[model samples]
Target: MSSRNLPDDKKLIDLQRFQLLVNAITDYAIYMLDTDGRVVSWNAGAQKFKGYTSEEIIGQHFSQFLTPEDQKAGIPALALQTAETEGRYETEGWRVRKDGSYFWANVIIDAIRENGRLLGFAKITRDITDRRKAEEALRLSEQQFRLLVQGVTDYAIYMLDKEGNVSNWNAGAQRIKGYRQEEVVGTHFSRFYTDEDQQDGVPQRALLTARTEGRFEQEGWRVRNDGSKFRAHVVIDPIYNAINEFVGYAKVTRDITEKYKAAIALKQTEQALQQAQKMETIGKLTGGIAHDFNNLLQIISGNLQLLSAEIAGNQRAEKRVTNALAGVRRGAKLASYLLSFGRRQALDPKVVNIGRFVLEMEDMLQRSLGETIEVETILADDLWNTFVDVAQVENALLNLAVNARDAMDSVGKLTIEISNAVLDENYARAHVEVNAGEYVMLAVSDVGSGMPSEVVAQAFEPFFSTKPEGKGTGLGLSMVYGFVKQSGGHANIYSEPGYGTTVKLYFPRSTELENCVVIQTVENIVGGTETILVAEDDEQVRHTAIEMLTALGYKVLHADDAQSALAIIEAGVKIDLLFTDVVMPGPLRSPELARKARELLPDLAVLFTSGYTQNAIVHGGRLDAGVELLGKPYSREALARKIRSVITNSIQR
Candidate 1:
């Protein structure tokens, strides 16, 4: 079966069959070249790829198929020489067709030898233009995708291995996580998690969830390379290969610390607004009730005064009347406290330096707190002035001191500090009812029993107290809250279970210079003979007023409402003073009635009275300018003094 023993014709047939097989291939060009680099044989594939017939291509130089640049560089000659010397040569480059077009080709040259005699070379050329183009497009697409991921700066995009180790890091990852690519790659992804999260196995859970569910997303606290923490919104998507084989994870993290803080502030502001609205509703209801109750107390008090005068000679009867009057006075005090909590009490605000004002009340505060309590005052230099009622301020301070005394069991220190302050926009955003501006700050701190958070939250609510039953009215803090709000101020209380308490009151700064304080001397309670017109809506209150004025030796005329009083004035009644209730059930208001009565009589005096002003004669919680007002539930002596004072001032004017 060896080729040497076979017949020459059989060998010739076998060689012809081999040539036929090589020539039948259409993908690779098969051809042979002489030692001089000229083509000697060509196949059908050579003809098809080179755009020439075998007869036309035979005997042509193989360099004709090479590009001009390759020809000029002698690459074809070098290839032939290398193949003859080294037995083979292979390369890939652009080749020219017979029609002058170009195609990417894989060329291989093999040395053909005949037993010590040099022969031609065998060359194979494959047109791989499609495969080359596909490979190049794939490389370019990968490069572009890498560039896109690297250019982003807001989100930390990175890759993690299946075991949750950092595999690759982009520029965005470096920027957001504060780590360079070299610093993070090959490190555990858990390093980016906070210590608490890591201890809770959050990082491991995230990877497991993503691998099983395809994706995992969450928002939480994350740590940076520098150990600083931020609120991060994170997403992890399990990566897969073309065949759907699980590979790793693609992680994206966004720093949302500022956004998170803003959301929290918005929620707190909403809660504060709700609290303010609730307090406002309660205040309205309390004010209305106090108004009506004060009217009833005034009727009882006025009638008791008339009976006291009639039974003056009977000691026992006089003593009982005195006790009844004291009871009425207590009721009136209770109503006054309710009015304060409702912000309906009339205020006489004046521009004064709060530091000096606090100093003036130091002695009174000391006396009220007794010897067991230690009082201290810290006044800042150049303290700002505030417009407020001096009497109310004194009352507020006294109330705080007394509460502090009771809290400490009368054995603690009370500190009152006054200073100028400025509330910025940040503070205003956190406190919905507060405005950003200059303020006069008055802080009262006590080294006594401290309140918890729950107590502090309810401290401003009426009837919410921590003291034992009957030990407190529970309106002290509520009254302070309403007064501060009515004066366009803010109050804040800070306390802990065992750390004592501090209450800060911020009043709007006053730009006006301080005014001189007016001191009024007490006048004797003497009745006047001046004719007075009493206008009251309540029948019992009107009758009580008439009886009191009659005993005071005044000629009193009575009217049930403002319209009736106006009619009497229009009828030319000789009236020296018009004592009118502020709120009336008539079309004619007390202010309008007083205006018309003055028009009819130039020297007539007008004195307004009310249990609650109801904003009729009160504006900004203060009485109107040049208007005289007497609060309700007054004693017989107070009515006499106010009436005499109003008439005497009118006659002088």
Candidate 2:
């Protein structure tokens, strides 16, 4: 129905119903204000919100509900003027209640005009303090979190978008990746990976794994902005929103280059220690076997020599005995090589300038290598002195030269370099068996077919040879290794396929003056007429020794062990010399027997013989001071010379 046709009473009832609806709202203060901003009408909601009764607040200016600052700024009047002219006004600010308390409020004003004439205005206000406080707290928490992430410097923490592009970077990310935040943001995260890694889709796989499995962690090489690479430990976690939807990834990376290198060095050292232990075990077994074999060779050699004397003038018999003797000598030489590899042979060390010694042997080395091999010696001007067995050094050099010649297929340059070297702690740490110290380095290099890593690993092992069977005994390198180690030195070999090979021996430097003593050769095997006491554990060795000495015109005495020999010495027997084996079964050791026998016979001469000294009369691979020693498996001539030499030296002393 049209408003003009409706009854006045019905219109009044409709207006009253609208008032009741507006008054029922308890959350919003609903009221009316005159054009001048005076409170002309108030509702129940206004009384509840402002803590005021209708009688107390009626006719009061609406400005009374505004804060003092807002009232002074004339905001209430402006609000009313805006509503009258523009029809409506809305704002949010602090408003005061009747009790003088302020609350954050949302306010609105609407003009109620009749026929374009000035009229009152309707106003509404809502308390919004709790919501404002919550929003403020959230903003503060986000700021603090951003600052925390930016302050870290040890780890690269960053955020990636859903498509793996960098969204945000922290200070740690800038420091570790060598890039500024402006340079990294909006770029693909794959740029931080190596080209190989990127080609393998490692970055994408990491993101996918994190998205599917919740997290991904790995260690690998990472490229920085400057293009340098480092070992990195990385972790990726899929970021999720409050509703559990995947947004992106949170990546963290740490540089672990030094730690990774240290781990690798430790592993290499462990492998070296294991190899050394294996070699040591093998040395012990070979040493024992060689010792026993030497004893048998000695007996056989002695019997053959005696047989040769019996078959004098008989060419056939003499030739047969001579061939047998040659066999025994070869067996003895084989046993000696084993002892050398085992580091069981006694050494006669002398201080020598290695450069001069090598120069003197240049002619011999040249002749040994043949015309096909070019020999070159690079000796340092002021090379250091080392205490070592001169004969053994010569042998070691010859062995290395021959090996180099063979490696070069008999047609390449062989270089021998001698120089002073100092090994530092870092080298010692990487090589477990090496000691950090000054050393005289002897390096031999060859331009030949190099060895692979597997072959180089077992190069020093006895019987491990690359040469065809029967072409090599395989003890050349092993003997050199043992001799260097026994002389308190280190041996190392470097080789690569198709390149070349170099073997370096580092001998401890010595401060002693060089000794150039010339050893006189005994051309004639002369016998002596003196009482000689032979003490040996093996029955055959003892009997053979007694017969040989008796044949040499000496009154020979025999004893099964050191104790028996000592008893005979204590019985006041006038003995010119004591020939005793170093290793015996009796409680009275050979060394002790020698000491006691010398005490009883003040002018007695002593000679020690051993297939194995077993550290009894040898210390640090050298014979004890003032002790005379003769190695086992000696020929008749050698036995005669050594016996006579000892007796004459003892009588002279």
Candidate 3:
């Protein structure tokens, strides 16, 4: 027979084999339903899957296998209608089994036809409950990740297109980058960088890095919408499709401005604290050296005075003695300067008109500066008077003049101007340790090559100078700084390269117009015959003190430390006064020793001394309330005066 006119034997054999294969499978419910929804045929798969024999299940209604809800909702009939119209209907839902229990099933109904006439439907169903649960879990995980990203406010999480334009924005992006979605979306991300960075093509470079290397990270200054600057940490990551095609980028940014500021402030505070500690250490060292050196000077001056007296009436020897006295005066001046720098020298603040003081120093400055340097003065006629140590001011000016001359190579213009001004609260707030009040401003401007900014910043640091080695001590500006601060004043320097420098010293205005009251020297005082006790650790200082007190008409008792002083006072040998150094090597303190002596003998007078005593025990060379004090290295005259003062004061008590 012709193949087109009759069925081939090969096709007949394939149909039988397909039927046999369908009957052999039992796990899948394979069956058929007629156009009226009746079970017309059932294979072994149907018999095994539904737990029914072909003889009992055939010719039964297909609706019996559907859930009650599916039946009540007409889902099975609707599915059959759809399959009849569209040729197939597929879905997954609850389907009934032989045990009357439901299983999640994937079902498909495919309409069958021959010669364009409806015949039946082929149905296939599968158990897929685990797969449905896995899909649900995956959906929940994606939701959680979205929430996590949205809650982050410190980081700017967003997306950018391949062209580097913002394609997405989150709350974090709006908060950190200071841009609303409407403002930033579709705009290039380069707008977030500073103008300088943008000009330098940093944004394009970042994009290139991300596209070429898959990621880019950087930290630097960024500008906000309001034109403020912040330190930002940024990351850009290139995104790609599943096919490995370049898609876009995801960008994240964070603001680290507050953290940066905190680090800088911590560094500044640490430096300030270190400077304060150094100053305290130097103060103690200065006081010790001054006390020891003063003693040596006293011996020299004293022996010389005696020698001059013993060799009286020799004109040549007298002239030599006069010159020696002048040298001794200069040595004393040097000691005073050291004491001033140490903040130990006594200051006699006097009120003087600022204008007149500048005028008075004009001639001295002109002579000291030489004819090569032009000296000019500007003094306000109605300037206010200021309270300060006149001699120290003169020295400070001289030091500044010498500095200016050196900076100019000995030829420059030195201008000294005095004026009255008021420092308001705003100004005081920016300055360290200064208050809002009236001030007398003394400005010293020099036309010479100026220092660099870095050098100017540290100009007041102790032992820091720019002059050639060995030519400068580096203590001039530091001394000026310390003295001005101790005198309730402020000092600052301003310099610009090639534009010269100006140093402005501000002294608090004085309410008092009277000249300084001179303090009486020990020579003008008298000694007393008080039984006094002295306590000192240094043997030389202790013996020198005892000898001076004895020579000044006082009965003296000596001790090496505070503990021995207490023992002597306890013995009750008519001790009229207790003299002890502040710092001792024993269990007893100077103050404690004084307290004990007063407790035993209520009439006992106390005088404390020390070369390295902290300021806690004394203020501005004045003793604490209800106490008497004599500083170390005292001479016979100083001892006499201190003894008389303490005794008279004790009598008054």
Q: List the residue pairs that clash in candidate 1.
A: none
Candidate 2, residues 382-442, lDDT tens digits: the string is 8889998888899899999999999999999999999999999989877767899999999
Query: Candidate 3 residues 522-576, lDDT tens each?
Result: 4564766878898877676666677666666778999999888888877868888
Q: What are the models' TM-scores? A: 0.85, 0.83, 0.67
What is the lDDT, from 0 to 100, of the residue 618 in candidate 1? Answer: 87
- What ranges in model 3 sit over 4 Å off? 1-13, 23-31, 36-111, 125-127, 204-218, 235-249, 300-398, 408-445, 484-492, 503-617, 620-653
Score candidate 3 by lDDT.
0.78
Candidate 1's error at 342, in angstroms?
5.2
Worst 10 residues of 1 by lDDT: 515-524
Single out the weakest 10-residue window by summed lDDT for candidate 2. 517-526
lDDT of each: 0.88, 0.88, 0.78
Task: Report the Cα lDDT for residue 457, model 2.
Answer: 91
Q: By TM-score, who's the top model here?
A: 1
How far off is residue 283 in model 1, in Å?
4.0
Comparison by TM-score, 2 against 3, better one: 2
